[model samples]
Target: MRILLVLVAAAGLFGCAALPGDGPAAINITTQDVEDSAQSGDYTVVTIDPGNIDAIRSYRPMAFANQFRGVGRGGSPTLLGVGDTLTVSIWEASPDGLFSSGDSGSSQIPSVVDEHGYIFVPYAGRVRAAGLSIEGLRQSVQKKLIGKAVEPQVLISLRDKLSSTAVVVGDVAKPGVYPLPLRDTRLLDLVAQAGGAREATYETVVTLKRGNRAGTTRLEDLIDYPENNVLISPNDNILLSHRPRTFSAFGAVKANQLVPFRTKSVTMAEALATVGGLRDERADANGVFLFRYEDAELVRRLKPELAEKLAGAETVPLVYKLGLRDPKGFFMSQHFEMRDKDILYVSNHPTAELGKFLQIIAPLISNYSTVQRITD
Candidate 1:
């Protein structure tokens, strides 16, 4: 009972070491006296750079697909352009005269709007067709010919409509501005016309610019739901882009690399699969480490202190170290839920560092050789 009481007191003392009363030197992992006797020239202190240490207090993923959800089916006004053909029918004129109207068999010259955005008629001379629709341009011409002709009546309709086409660039197979027909075309139909996002990665994000205003949206969101595939207006610029994915993984892996997640959520097993799994020969199966952030004091803060506090009571919470050598561990990997920017590290034998060092140095040497060849 006396020995048990002594052990309990020692455990309580160890717990007090983290409290505020533990003095300034308590931050050191080991005592100076112990370091001096160890004789291996004192252990190298690991200085944690603030930049390298990821502190997860409050973090949210960047907004995505918001613009896609808000796309509407409304059609905006469109302007007329050159190379457009129009059929004009005028009253009180013969087939050989200045104005004439006949059946569909009549081979009349389809009035071509010139580079100056104007068309020439016998009575009206040259008039601007740039900003005016077919009916609007015809009405202006009819008003101009009223004094010259006997109460002139005019009708105009588009014969060819290839002058106005919206440009769709980037990521699509065959990207170009396609001419829109009589009815308003939806976003998905335009994508189909351009051969879709052939080179797009994961959730493809696209930008649509109409006039001076621009908005972004995901292609998948529009494709997945019928609502988002709304009508695209004329003069709208569509851009398809593959945004880079950013993530980092560390610990007892063969090669640690910052690979693209290409997804919203990634499993621990999938993360391991990305780095070619743990080094089977050198890894310590029992020392796998997953480091995540904890801000408990920040969670339970007073209202007054919350305003000024950057952060409080930060900790590197670790997860279970599975013995994958055992058969049951393969199943345990399924339960692990990986958060954004979390580092999953598996511990390994000391010699594994040599492989890591060589892997890093080889790239630098190769890059130096390439520079020499280029200079020579």
Candidate 2:
């Protein structure tokens, strides 16, 4: 009975043997095995160094000027459309002229473009205004009243624009459809008109949809890069959203939390620092790994040999190792940027697992000896 009690206590304590960074034997993969697999073309592995850092930077997606070319610009004036209100003023040279009102020989007419793109004039009849600029419509009205009126001079101006507008929604202080002005209105102008984004600049993502085409850009980049704030086109839909970039930290890091980047880009060192760095006692200094899915085209450009192994893959799974034991590794970490959704894992020191096993069994051994003494 005494021996059986000791065996039961030992078995119960052995159940707690699993430690940090320990996994099932079938799934356990060592750092050396990862390195060997990368060398054998089973997976792409990159060492975080100055040259590789520059290569990764080259592959980083850049925000270019929205190349959506259409009708909205300074070169082309705002054309008339349905539901647009216009003010027409006609002037005559003589007091007894056709539009004489209280001897001023001028009249102000308020007209709205109809469904058929035409506006009515007393003598000019139904005149087509849609698809014509303000100046163009003025010329059309003058030509219609040429024979009837005495050398009529016409001027036209937009009173209220209703048809030509862009819809702004999501993550803004005010979400509504804003009308585009007669002059060229830009993307930033429309966003400002809607009361600006509710989130931080770095956290905001602005997507522009024009017709069937769509483009997305970071709000911060749009503000910093002038070209990204392109002219807003009619019927364009602007969506402002907050999608904060983050990366996951696991294994022997001091704090294993989903860390968010405060800026557009964060270096590996910055990410590690944000998470309180690696645990000195448990972390294996040479086993830091960053896991991410990289674009195949970029992989091909950077490492053709690895690219060949992943020919059929759209995106290649890549793991980058950083040896913190080396004095120069700290410098390399500063250059290596941590992309969104990346996983930063620091494997535990091999001896740490053995120490944990000893810790769990030591209590069981003491309990067993105490039970034996009681039985005796």
List the candidates' TM-scores in order: 0.44, 0.75
Model 1 C-alpha lDDT versus the unseen true structure? 0.57
lDDT of 1 at 185: 81
Supply the TM-score for candidate 2: 0.75
Q: Where is model 2 poorest over a 10-residue stretch in terms of lDDT?
A: 22-31
For model 1, the stretches where C-alpha displacement exceeds 4 angstroms are 1-76, 79-109, 112-117, 122-124, 141-155, 159-165, 177-189, 200-218, 221-237, 241-248, 252-255, 258-269, 272-376
Best by lDDT: 2
lDDT tens digits, residues 79-145, model 2? 8899899899999877788787885679999999999999998899999999998889999999999
Tens digits of per-residue lDDT for model 1 on 1-376?
4664575456445544433211112122223343232223232221122221222212222222234344443343455677666776677544544454454322233587788888877778887887787778978988888877666677777765566667899888999867766567877788889998875534467788766556665676565455655567766688998664445666557678786776755666787888888777656665555545433332223112332232332331323244565655555565454654566666655444444444545665677678879999
TM-score of 1: 0.44
Query: What lDDT is reached at residue 291 by model 2?
Result: 82
